[model samples]
Target: MPLPTGPVIGIMMDNLKKRKSVFPISGRKAVKWSQKLEIPVGGETVLYTGSMYQLLPYMIAAVNRMGKMEDSFLGQYVGLGRFFNKMFNVSSIMFRPKRADHKRFRRIIRDIARLLQQAGVDFGYLYKKELYAGALAFDLGVDETFVAHAQRLSNLFKAQGVRSLITIDPHTTNVLRSVYPTIIDGFDIEVKSYLEVLAENDTLRPINKVEGEITIHDSCVYARYEDVVEQPRQLLRRAGYTVKEPKNNRNLTHCCGGPIESLFPSMAHQIGGKRVQQLKDAQGKGVATMCPICMATLQQAANGDLEIDDIASFLAKAFCPPGANDKSAEEKRSQP
Candidate 1:
């Protein structure tokens, strides 16, 4: 049976066009991770999430449901789903991620922010004003929609007085740093991945001194398009962990099968599983992913056979003091 690529992508583009996010997530939910951190409204340089991490749990849930629908008799209804999605948010109905999943991804975002703060990087958050980078629209080649969205984002930056961006993920970093400039006239935001910022900062050394070996799963956009290959490895090595390289690493990194997961879920899982095997061959304590999609996709493929985490989590564990800025620990402490 043919995958419902057109309908799936159509739904995503519609969401991007209408909601300003790839998923039906509200701006408050998108920016919730930064609330406790008390990040300022705007600054010369801002921490741009692009809603990638916040949207991941929702994306993962939607893809899981889509995979089942595609493999079963329900595949035929996808077109109808897309149609209903236009009138009403069918995605919110069909793709409700688990509470634990939501918390995990949110924690990753907080960890990233905490790591940046620990590194002494002065950055602000746009909060509700930050928009998704239209990565899926660009990846799916929806040029008209993507360009309009990019321009909208550029205008937001211009209005917010944002001169630079510290992006959290590879797709967002690549789009803002590379793609937006090509499409939007006078798009002059200086974008750098948080990894690059931390790697370049000499004062951001690890205080905890973690001991272990972790395999690095390089994001394709980061490694190939943005030259972000070395920054993550450098950060990990600086934290006292032996960086293990899979067979396909750095510029030659294999895809985590996430870009196509929405349209071809099972196929994406298959590709992710293969990549998981390659990482396992490296015989590390765990796998560290720089992209939320990579972490989610490879985790689904690993399914307890391997431990996978976002790179920020490891960095936070090494860089942050015990219980400092730890939301989960605070929550537990407040739980009675």
Candidate 2:
């Protein structure tokens, strides 16, 4: 049966950017489906604010954009896209809108309009709902928004038929797993991190040995959010590489300062600098993070100081045992 219209499971997502290096193609879809199935997903501020946090995003884009930032080229390219999107929406509003059929999109856009109004965007409220989740925390890096959103999700579990929530990264996972349960009514929903499920299939192991010394940044989300300290370490070790942990490893792991990016881009740098220093201190050749967002954000923040790899990418490129690379294995992974 189709779900009734009102009060559908809420997913507080970040805004969509044209060329995002931080989020993987799969990350957004993975979370989208999770929300569609009644599992709620949330994020920090959906868009880049004009605060210092803008610097990291700008920096990340410059590093990844190759040559888009030079001599007014960026505004010409990105500006035109934003212009067309609004124009398309306005024209659609003047006539018909595909988004009107999408309750989720409608709701998020409304929220975005409100935030913009509060931030004073003077666009006459282009929406009626909060299209993007607000910042998780007000700077200094915290997961308050995730926890609050999850708790809000907890309020709907009975009717939504949602028993579990899943997060793609450690930052989100940590808040959903630990902090949320301790606050509000406590999201009674079971929150699972994606990698744990991905690890369920033994055949899903690495394909080739990732040679060289490697270290895992037990994201605050994975380590503190869900006590996922040992699993990633074990996975990395099994993939035939020595795993070195920073002194402040596990639950005590420091924030990569991603949440602070919006308020203090430089502070985000300071935090990221500390994290990279830890990896360097360990003398590891590369760093692995479970969240694509983390991998991208930290890589940008590190400014090429250390190599950052997502766990999946790390596993995909590394050696796998015999038969693990077979067709049957791939088929099984897509079963759900």
Candidate 3:
């Protein structure tokens, strides 16, 4: 028996309301760390959207959940979910071992900072004052909460004297760039992806060469919707790595199985696996992903067969090579 998408969506909504994340336990820990570091947990962006576009996954899931779904794992998971929901009034939506990890979270943040430093970009963190962009809520069709949250974020930026934002992920980049201006009146905040900022400037030269082909996985939000297709590739090329394209690349790229992961874990895995296979077929030793969700999904799908990293990490290694002196890296940044 296939579980209806409505129920799955309902369950996710319930979980989001209570757990505040599809990956509840991990989300909570990420949130705690975000507070501790004074940086926003990049994934918490869902708590702030009213866009129907963001709800398309649910609509598609609803249609798919109607019959025997394609993936056996998802079918079994859904079956277990129905049993729990019916018997105990408990939903199996909040799965454990969430994609978000505290260590990785910190690493991503630091990687971006290092990437910027290597690029000769002078930037400062809002530190304890940064708020989650509420991307997930916006994606899940919880517009009212998203709007309120957006207003709060806007106010925070103003209060903190933030003139510009350098976002790490596509989700945060999309919400802050495409969504914020429309909802928040008189929105004057300048939002740019860190990749975009680096690409626009030529000051960051790659001193260390990274050898071999690195497959690039474009985030849907980053590529098609936001048209951030070239920035990462430009950075990658500058870093001295040959960029390879899979069957699906750029605007036509396949989903990493992330957007639908929370609602259909097995299906998400299936999609991610297929995409990873496609990248592998391209014969790249490693894959480079720009989005946090894409990085997580593709890495899960790779299962150790291929190396995967966020583009920031790739750039960090290229500019700040492992064996290089930290003082030299800093001195390079300080040069005219």
Candidate 4:
């Protein structure tokens, strides 16, 4: 059952009113004019349906945990998040595990645990106002559009025999797979961050004949919202590039100001500009990012002062060893 081209708002409201659901429903096209957006694994940016609150459960638990903690630590986490956009991947900063003040990391783990537990108790959470209202009561909120789109995605993927999903970006992954299932029906899908997939595959290659050093910017969605890290650096080393350290990396990775462009423009630009300068400071020759949103931001901010690219783009430029196959590794990289 492929999701509808875009969410059927009428159907959604009807479902809401009736408290019944047609699982794995699709939505109408998000953008009109026969348009599509590119996403990994062949997702064509078509709207899909899922549990009303696949990501809600985590939001709920996290808010509760954070509320029980000191306010200063939470504020500091925000500041550190922006500060960490430089060197390490978002996962490094957010999941450092060693950082004393990383309440979000702890809270995120707890939240996941709670959601998983809830799934065992109930079938799964359904999309509902109760979920949102519950979060708001706790002073937590998420986007309405995202929830709508995510529901369509969960239903779409499930129909495709994808009981487990590896989300490349944290925001989408968490919202679509984590919270909604908790709220809607508690889907049995296994959700893991994309970096974990790469690491699990052990794709890290040895550093060899490499171009000069480069710095990588981890997307906040993966680091903060989702918690992906390390895989990109491993890929860099495998691709024969030396990595440069930036002021901030990992958990504290700076937001590319994407998707959030509606919320803050100048702030995102400032963050991207600062990230580029850090690369220059380290004398790295180029900038690498795992997320397309970050790639666009760095390019706009770098303004061609530096080479900005996504990890996939870089992998496609394989600097192969001499006497390799007649078809150069670069050629093979190009093939895929």
Top candidate on lDDT is: 1
For model 4, how does the per-residue alpha-carbon lDDT over 56-125 read when each residue is reduced to its tens digit? Answer: 2222222223333323345335334333422223222232221211222222222222222222211122
lDDT of 1 by residue, 1-336 (tens): 545778888888888888777798987688777767888889989999998999988998898788888768898888888898999898998999876677788888999988888888898998887888898889889999999999999999998889999999999999899999899888888999999999999999788969899999999999899999888999999988999999999999999999889888888999999999999999999889999999889988988788788899888989987575454654333211
The models' CA-based lDDT, in order, is 0.87, 0.43, 0.65, 0.43
Candidate structures ordered by lDDT, highest first: 1, 3, 2, 4
| Candidate 4: regions farther than 4 A off | 1-148, 202-210, 319-336
After superposition, which runs of candidate 2 have C-alpha atoms over 4 Å from their true positions? 1-160, 179-187, 198-204, 319-336
Better of 2 and 3 by lDDT: 3
User: Positional deviation of 270 in candidate 3, in angstroms?
Assistant: 1.3
- Separately for all candidates shown, the number of backbone clashes (residues 3 or more apart, or on different chains) is 0, 22, 16, 48
Clashes of 4: 48
Candidate 2: C-alpha lDDT: 0.43
